[model samples]
Target: MSPRIGYFLSCEEYSPSQLIEQAKLAERAGFEALWISDHFHPWNDAQGNSAYVWGMIGAISQACSLPITTAVTCPILRQHPAIVAQAAATAKVLTNGRFTLGIGTGEALNEHVLGQRWPNTDVRLSMLGEAVDVMRQLWTGESVTHHGDHYTVEDARIYTLPDEPVKVYVSAFGPKALEVAARIGDGLCSTMPEADVVSSFKEKAGPGKPAQVGYKVSYSTDPERALDYAHELWFNEGIPGEAAQVLSSPKHFEQLAPLVTRDAVAGSTVHEADVDKHVAEFAKYADAGYDEVFIADMGPEYEGFFRFYEKDVLPRIRG
Candidate 1:
């Protein structure tokens, strides 16, 4: 069976109004759901904009009927897990239970604003594990008092909540994080089309758990323009390794952006208007066993992007 296809909203690139517009467009374009990025800062200043994701979610809930998930929020830092729990619960109520909280260990790019010491990978993962435990306890509508290794919550309870606990989809990129996702996540969230990742998650999470993956494409009638947008707006995507996870500022990313070549970006993304290529990209994730695949169009060609997908790409994929 074909996996459900959704649209990804890039909060780092678009304003609140634009994000909400894309949410409505995705619904109208026959996309099954929405994945909105949660970031405190853009990877580079060129992609400028980082609205608080909770506020965006509330606004988006009123504007569109499609379900929404934070592409991945870091509840471990920047926001307390208890606060994240309340916000997520309110979001679930606002969306009439269509809101899912997608969480991860997070990056210093967003979490360093508070000037807290950046922990190592093992420590961050441990914090994330504890944070998820704190959130889940609060979601039960009982007063929660948690004093764990990384977080402390005192008699906190979420008053506004949906009938069901907000579903959590954990985002994982490495083996350790994947293990946590399998153990705690109601679903798995990822950006890569890796069959082994999905199979491992399903094996550990057991039957009936869903896995979602998202990626970006730059669509334009002029293929060169598409390539240009991908390179100009998202060269950070080409940055190697843990730089993305450890970089503390957008300037640091901008400084390294020059090292990323257009060809590198081209090799990684579908930066063209070709419907066949677009369909094939989604198929890669579906074939990898993702239950859902989300695509984000980079730059200002989103209107054309939606039209192209709705008319040409989606039907072909569904057929």
Candidate 2:
């Protein structure tokens, strides 16, 4: 298959059943994979929505037939390594061996539950390194016995493991973490979708490791309406905070439709309605040498978005 095309899902959407239906549609639409977000709380005052990620993913497994994994999940702080390993192993089995475990150090908002300490990025990455190490040992059916900077296991073994190794995809933003991904992970995941990032990651990760980037557009027949929703639901992702670290996607506020104001929507997607313009943004990442790009549309114009993507975009770049 050519470099993969995928669909994105937010764990916070209203109708998870609808989300599952969308995944089936994506499979029928020729999408290669599905990436779902992992979140704990929505800060109702801000985004006004948040759904249980693993539960939703379970629904996706039952409702749709597609390869699935979280775009990125924090295994270090939000949950324990053994728990994550067991859950991921089960998911791999449930998905018919089509699951990849994408992980990251994580953001404070999601990790600070139960009053656990939220370390800085460097420390968090260090923790993740050890966490992955622990999970790997457990997944290997080994009676793990180790003491690391952040985690420890005592004769632990996952009773259930997939027949095949569960591909571990790591989310990295900068140089140091990228190097760690190269040395340890099976693949790299990033939101930047910049070619430079992919090349840098591959160099440190060495050859043959998976490198996937995610990008989204507000696809709609009417550019204006899509852009409006982009500002509302998508724009907050652009906000500057610990929350924004995970949501590194950028916005060209000045370049988009000038009329859409800050008050109208949570994001500046008013200009995203133009399918060509929207896909053009995604192409920048593809050109950057990413092996896959997962594009999630913000509004209901999914069919329209898929048509434009398959006809206008895929023909030109997909190999």
Candidate 3:
């Protein structure tokens, strides 16, 4: 089956108003849903914005009817899982159950602001599992007092909750994290178009569990200009491996941004106006068997981006 297409709102690059506007535009353009990044800081200063995601989500719920999911929020640190439970429950109610809580073992870039020691990947994955357990307990609307390895929740109960528990979609890349995700996650969330990963997730997670993937693109009439915009604002996307996860600050990312070349960014992202290229990019996720695919525009040309997808790209993919 062809995957449902959605728009990704880059909170790292767009202001709250811009995100709300994009959400409305995406729905009007025939997009089915929305994915919004949750971040404390932009990857670099060039991207330049990080509004509180929950607050933006509240505003976005009022502005558009499309379902919203945090591309991935880290609940282990910076914010306690108990607090995240309350926030997510409220979001579910605000969206009238059109919300999903997508979570991951977060990055130091966002989690380190509270001065907590950044745990290694294995430890982080363990904490994530416990965090999900904590959140799920609170979502049942019963008072929860969890004294676990990583977290301690005093007598706490979420007063506001939807009719059903908020569905949790886990974001993962490596094997260990994927294992945890399969065990606990209601669905899978990823950015890579790796067929093996999706297949493994389905095999382990069983039927009726959906998987989603998101990718970045730059859209403009002049493809070269689009490449320039992509490199200028999002060159950090080209940074390979664990650097993105361990980097403590936006300045740290900025220092590495110089090493990332235009070709590196161009190679990974579709920075063009060509309909076939955009359709082909979406097809990669569909071929990988993701149930949903989200596309995020890289630069300021988003108005044109929406129009291009509406008139050209979406039809080709759906047709």
The Cα error of candidate 3 at residue 78, in Å, is 0.7
lDDT of 2 at 303: 69
Model 2 — TM-score against the truth? 0.86
lDDT of 2 by residue, 1-319 (tens): 4468788876654457767778887887778889988877542232445677777777889877788978788889778887888888888888889899999987665677667777878888888888888888888887888888878777777887889878899998777888888877999988875777788888877888978888767766665677665765555545443545442212332233234455545343325545456556767777788887887877556667667666666666554
Distance (Å) between predicted and true CA of 256, model 3? Answer: 1.0
Worst 10 residues of 2 by lDDT: 247-256
Model 1 lDDT on a 0 to 1 scale: 0.92
TM-score of each: 0.99, 0.86, 0.99
List the candidate 1 regions with Cα displacement exceeding 4 Å: none
What Cα-based lDDT does every candidate model obtain?
0.92, 0.73, 0.93
Alpha-carbon deviation at 248 in model 2, angstroms: 16
lDDT of 3 by residue, 84-115 (tens): 99999999999999999999998899999988
Clashing pairs in 3: none
